[model samples]
Target: MTVTLQLEQLSIMPGQRIVLRDVSWQQFEAILTELGDHRASRLAYDNGMLEIRMPLPEHERSKVLLSDFVKNLLEALDIDFEPFGSSTFKRIDMAKGIEPDECFYIQNHAAMIGKRRLDLTIDPPPDLAIEVDLTSKTQLEVYRVLGVPELWRYESGRLRIDVLQSGRYVESPISPTFPDLLLVERFPGFVEMAATAGTRPALKAFRQWVKEQLQL
Candidate 1:
């Protein structure tokens, strides 16, 4: 006798992830459909590997706060952007798919505005993506295969910036998006401040800091 379990039957606790091996593209699509849009767990698929993760409350808090910082930075600079929070981006040809914690279209904002759906074959990947790596490590290879230009990963109270170069990611001390601002140094402090001083106050202070930087 043999028994098989459905995806729905599996319960993924917060801050935990389960990897499924030898998963095909068609099966991945079916799993996405079964999971639907209103779910909390995030998924990443690369070649024949699939990883599903459930974010803890701490993970979510950091994601939201840091995402807010991105928005505030873009706004202060008066730059146009489109925030696509945790949207699934995939390409069948590459056999890769990933859902970012938060993503933004800055340079490519004009092209993505008002778009209801994404087709990676024709449309360009997001200009920047944010990943809160408190729960499970982010799959950098998946993002690279999908051709995301920039990625920001936050872990252990520090932020790491990576820029795609020659089809690979290189750790950079400065962000290509905000060359004038020192986000790698400043963002972590603000995120920590948010944890103790509260979101709104921390954001308010961050906005002031950005304004001060502009004056310098």
Candidate 2:
């Protein structure tokens, strides 16, 4: 006897994830359609492996704060960017897909402006992708296969910068996008500040800090 479970029947608790193996790309697409776009959970699919995760409150808070910091940095530097927050990016040819906590098109912002749909074969991947590693580890392989230039992973209250170099991610001390700014050194503190001092106040303080750095 065999039993089949509907995607809706499956319940993933906050800060937990469920992994399914041997899922075909077609099946992945169906699952995504079934899951729809109005949920809090995140999904990652690499070839035949699929992971569905439900984020905790802390995870959501961190994701928003970090995304805000990135926006602030770009604005302070007077760089134009298009933010695609948690939008599912997938390539059928590559057989890989991921929804980042926050993603931005910085260098290729102009190309992506006013785009409603993304065709990875013709369209470039996001220049920067941010992942908050609280419930599940980031599937770097999927990001690499998609050819993302820069990946920011926040784990254990610290941010790790990884740049795609010759088809593999190499850890770097400084962000390629903001080499002059010490984000790895400064961002974690501000994330913590948001928890205690409130989101608006922390963001205001961070903006001030950015101004100070720029003046120096």
Candidate 3:
């Protein structure tokens, strides 16, 4: 349940990624707490593999843009959702742990409605996870182990909607929650537009666009 490697720093794209080898579950928990209130570093642990990477300013920028867009879209559609941004999710039985860049409980919103702490043993996983992948590639295996149903991955200035099927993620042409929207052809460009527009303007523009689409 661990990768035994030295805490070596490898120079990558934006920030430093420190990889630790042979870490115990207790140590991981301690480190997470030690990291208390630090928002810029991201942590990933699967089995015994532990990776911590400091996030760049631009990374946070793109993440917020995409996050706001999804939240705004949900509101416009009048869909009840609970946003969980960068919340740690771990299952001891599965030996996997991860925190999505942003996640939402939609289809199962009612199940988790008004709740705070999420224990996978009792609470269902988020129906959709939003991942901003420009900084690094997300570990799909983590999501698979957690049994998330859908993923929205944004990378290299593009957006993709994926749905999990039979223990694997496949590129989906449209979103399950927002089924009427055609993602492959129209949504990617729209994503860029909204991200560029900033949150307030983006919400205004998105609500207008959604109304036009629904003819409301």
TM-score of each: 0.96, 0.96, 0.86
Whole-model alpha-carbon lDDT for candidate 1: 0.91
lDDT of each: 0.91, 0.90, 0.76
Model 3: per-residue Cα lDDT over 1-216, one tens digit each: 944533333444455676666678888887778777546777778778887777677677778777777787888789998888888888888766777778999999889877877789889888988877734443577887788999888877777887888988888888888888665565556666655765667667767777887874
Q: How close is candidate 1 to the true structure, as a TM-score?
A: 0.96
Q: What overall lDDT, based on C-alpha atoms, would model 3 receive against the true structure?
A: 0.76
Q: What TM-score does structure 2 among the candidates reach?
A: 0.96
lDDT (tens digit, per residue) of candidate 1 on 125-154: 999999988344447888888889999999
lDDT of 2 by residue, 150-194 (tens): 999999989999999999989999999998888899988998899
lDDT at 191 for candidate 1? 88
lDDT of 3 at 5: 38
Ranking by lDDT: 1, 2, 3
